[model samples]
Target chain A: MSLVKTIKELKEEIKRMSYGKDISIGFVPTMGYLHEGHISLIKKAKLENDIVVVSVFVNPTQFGPNEDFESYPRDIERDYNLSISGGADIVFNPNVDEMYPDGASTFVNVKGDITNKLCGKSRPTHFEGVTTVVSKLFNIVKPTNAYFGQKDAQQVAVIQKMVRDLFFDINIVSCPIVREEDGLAMSSRNVYLNEEERNQALILSKSLFKARDMFLDGERDANVLRKFIIDNINTKELANIDYVDIVDAKTLENVETINSKAIIALAVKFGKTRLIDNIYLEV
Target chain B: MSLVKTIKELKEEIKRMSYGKDISIGFVPTMGYLHEGHISLIKKAKLENDIVVVSVFVNPTQFGPNEDFESYPRDIERDYNLSISGGADIVFNPNVDEMYPDGASTFVNVKGDITNKLCGKSRPTHFEGVTTVVSKLFNIVKPTNAYFGQKDAQQVAVIQKMVRDLFFDINIVSCPIVREEDGLAMSSRNVYLNEEERNQALILSKSLFKARDMFLDGERDANVLRKFIIDNINTKELANIDYVDIVDAKTLENVETINSKAIIALAVKFGKTRLIDNIYLEV
Candidate 1:
């Protein structure tokens, strides 16, 4: 296992590893501070591919003006230990300069419906940033299969759309969301929550799980499920609802009557720490 | 020497060809009419790489509403023969539907100063389309080295910027502009010119060459060179000038006085056919 920093070095290592062999590479792209969610992806990658590469880049472009870009967590030593234990062959942790040099003006933008809803409503520039950095990483690490977490359900959809649209010859394997034992979805930003806020954050997953139960118990109307989740989240005095949308799983378009696969996704803020969670409703 | 139409087939062929060996693939992306410029690119690719893949795609997104996308000349048979003679291993000519399937909305855009000037002023969405399709092609082909012509100087600059910005890892080899014996730059659209229009189109290259000679003879003022080319093109009664400006070669920003390397690029119309030409001024 090797932890590389520069693009040149990473490429050299990859070339050395796959010199004469037709090796399959599984890439897990993350923002470092690896948790169970990322480790699960790495473990799955290790199982499937001959080599597994995990990219730990906290892309600055994804954060908004008031967003916690500065306050975003970083613990490379711990991340390295976690990645090694999780079976990551390569941990690529490049600095801001290495990834984005001066005058880097090119952007990969996914316009229209799929990108305009959900997290994109308030964070306009987020997906563009994600797609651009992902493109750069994809080019650098030409993996056979790339792993993503279903915790960011919309991100997976957006990335899947980008891969299909742009003809990226790699399978996007979306791993299930890893959560805490108390039903709170795991997030790096969860560190920002105080003890009380951490307890309040449970409302996100708790509401979604309850809504899932309602959905499974024959609740067909989209508005009813949305109201249940929204009202449930609103009950916690500290939690402020950003959006509670029940949309078609594939297209991310709002579903009126859930006859097919749909995702009940939402975002809420506990103090300054914003958290997101979702549950799929399939018939 | 096979002409593959589908992406799956092409990928399979490429995999078979480079199954266990470290072989370089050179890509020449063209719109197919089999001109000298394209042949030059293929010839260069053949010289440098073990496998050469030529893609003949008449990208619709690059052409604007009033542009000549529908009337664009295409002869796949001639293109195949040309590719064969040029030592191309495979000719990839996927249809528009194959390249851009349903719900393809992602676009790679190189924003700001570089793309805004030159041809971008008249055709706003032109560079976005070019970048998007090229990115898709790059993803599909995954060529070690991609060849381009310097005739579209701005395009070469834009693509180079995109590659660097996005970390595309493929070397963009810019071949010199191949011109007719009479010095008119060779283009697929040259076929669109009527006999009379063809005769008048020479003024573009003639003026550019004259400006080059003047620059070589110590003319530094950009406005003087601009006026000379504009005035020279105006001498032809049928020629309508679109733009005549001298700018830095790499940045594409207008150069007031040519101190270092610069490009005197211009666009003009003969009847319904619009033409472009440029000459590099290097100290």
Candidate 2:
């Protein structure tokens, strides 16, 4: 139930925990405004480790010039209570100056085709920010296992790649995405939508379900499946489609025929807010 | 005196150490040869931290094709003695497999104009390897303070930038270069030079001194200083000049005049080996 604000305090607190020989530490890192999705990640971490530490940081480096960094929602007190309820042992809530000081300059880039596809195409520096912050958090916590939600699919992939490439001695465990009863993916940005916009936002998850239905019906052509999803989203008046594609689940590359594993991912703009949803289909 | 190979064991050992509250951890990473240059770095780390960890990793990622990766010198026992003698609390000597497992894919790049100049020109992938390995070492050790020799001046600058940009919680302490009695900067590569080659290798450092002499004598034109060094190297029949330049110290861009801080660096081929040396002058 205790909240640690600085790296020094956090490290000191972590050292005091009775992490005996072979003790496993679990970590969940999130940009606050904690909802069911973030809670799910923290809950999973709690299940797997002797101690679980959750960090809430709204990193600025991930947002582009035109992106909504200034207006990103935050509620630390609420987040703190939720984290404790979710079974988190410690909550690391560092300020902007604590995580990133004045004149700070290092960056961790997850390179290659993985970074150039999907969400990377729209927000170029987003993964870099995620990777860098994740790296910093990993070093701070030094957890045995770290939990990530599949809501940010590309983020999961980028972090996996970075951990593998860098030889970090920690396990990266990805959990399933949490969704609302209406099938809309749970996200902090969902709070920005009005009642009518919230109703229309359900189309994103519906389009993904439609694609899933096509896969269930034995349709495998990536192009045809992608077109079907795009066409469905295009029909929605409020949901303006940003991108729709069926790509390899692992590589995130556009596959011609979905013979193995494929993912259908799309980003839709519902008024001023953007929402993303994806479904993984395995043949 | 115990040697730990696996990361699991190393972490356990580190956890047992009583790094007192508010105590800083200082790290010095090197490829083992037990040279005075490495010892100098270790001594500095000891002075700066309550606990000192020195990592000896022969990072394969930093070696180029036709470069001496296999033939890289190693004496772990000697290195162990040297590290202990220099006051290093722990020596993290992980093998290549431990550091980089099969099918590793992540890399850390310290970009900008600093990477495009000096040693970067001839060894294109060298800095990438340096940056990547140093990043891995930094993550594994998780030091409060890390030490590097200014012998690799460009590398020190790149690491400083990487630590700042990436938001790693470590202080990068740059120590002065250790030199031989004859003025040659100590490097593992210095072992590649034959007796005559070693003697001829003095020209690399000698040229820097010549540049410094000119700068102290109120020489302002960078081109004239560069020409003087290149002409001096050309006069030595045993030396083949690889690159000679006078550039801005910080940006590494070629300078028209030496009215500001500048670095005069050069690489020379002596028989089959390449030796590099440089001098920074506040002009």
Candidate 3:
């Protein structure tokens, strides 16, 4: 396994590995804090591709002015071990200056109604930064298949749309989100929560599960599902509701009635820390 | 020479050509209606790379609602002959559907100052379309180096900026403009003018050449050069001036006095046909 830090060195390594051969390159991009969710994505990529590359980048562009960009978290040695064990041939850990060099002015955007719903409402310019960095990664990595976790289902949708609309010749493999035994979604930010806050945060997924059970038991009204989830989260101590939406899974548009596939997504704040969770509902 | 009309066939052919070889592919993308200018670009690419592919696409997104998109010239057969003669090994000619699949919602944009100058001022949404399509083409073709004519100098700058920003590992080669014996810059749109209009259109180039000569003879005042070019174009009957700008060649900013490299560019209309010409100056 080769670890590279610069794009030029990474490109050379990828070239050496892929030269004169038809190697299927798989890529898993993350923000340096490796968890079970990220490992699941890496394992999925490893199983499917001849060569696997994992990138650890804490992209500052995706965070808003008030977002937790400065204190996101980083553990290079832990991540390196986890990634190698999870089956990554190359670990690409580029610095901020390398990923976004001086005078980087171009951006790839998915316009219209797609970016205005769900998580996008709070983080307005978030997806633009996501699409831009992903585009750059796609170009630099030139992967045959790319892995993304379903924990960020909206991000999966945005990236899939970006690839399709931009005509990128790569497959997007969306892996299921890994979670703890208590059913809380596996997230790097979970460490920020105190023990009490951590237990309270489980209510996010617990509430979504309750709503899903209700959904499976003949409840189809979007407003009913949204209100039920919101009410459940409101009862938990130290839990403040951010938003609860029942939206079309594909378009991310709020649906009045759940006649088709939809995502029951929400965000909740546990004091200083904010966490997001969702469940896919299908008729 | 392979002539492909579908993206799939083209991709397969390019892949086959690229497999098991250390080959450098050079690309020339253009709206069909090939002339000596486009041929010059093809010839330049042919000389520099191991394989050459020229794309003939009339991109509609770059055209404004009132612009001449419907009337844009296209001659596939003539273009094929010229491209083969001009040293293009493959001509990837895709339809509108192949280039821009249905529900294409992604776009690449260079914001701030670059897109607001020169032809961009007249066609506001032009460079976005150019970057989007060119980005798509770059991905589809996977060229080592891409060629563009300096006739569209601002486009060259925009594309160069996009390539650098997006981290595309392809070199951009800007070829010099090919001109007629009468000093008129060659353009596919040149066919829109009649004989009288064509004769008067020479003033566009004639004034640019006059300014270049004066600059060589120690004229450095930008205002004076702009006024001189404007006056020379104004004297011709049936020619309506659009704009004359003396701008820094690199930044495309207007200069008070020509202390460094500059581009003295102008646009003029003869009848319903708009013609553009420019001259590069350096101290």
| Candidate 1 chain B minimal-lDDT segment of 10 residues | B13-22
Candidate 2 lDDT, A1-283, residue by residue in tens: 5799998888877777855344678999999999999999888888888888999999998998899999999999999999999999889999988877765556678777788777888888888888878888887788899998888888888898898777677899988889999998999999899998898888888878887898899988888878887887777788777788788877787899888877888888989998988888978
Residue A241 in candidate 2 has what lDDT?
76
What is each candidate's fraction of native interface contacts (fnat)? Answer: 0.99, 0.53, 0.91
DockQ of prediction 2: 0.39
CAPRI-style quality class for the chain A–B interface of candidate 3: medium
Better of 2 and 3 by DockQ: 3
Error of 2 at B222 (Å): 11
Query: What is the DockQ score, from 0 to 1, of model 3?
Result: 0.80
Model 1 error, position A77 (Å): 1.4
Candidate with better lDDT, 1 vs 2: 1
Q: TM-score, chain A, per candidate?
A: 0.98, 0.97, 0.97
Worst 10 residues of 1 chain A by lDDT: A13-22
TM-score result, candidate 2: 0.76
Score residue A33 of candidate 3 by CA lDDT: 90
Higher DockQ: candidate 1 or 3?
1
Best by TM-score: 1
What's the residue-level lDDT of A122 in candidate 2? 85
Error of 2 at B151 (Å): 2.5
Q: Arrange candidates by TM-score, highest first: which order?
A: 1, 3, 2
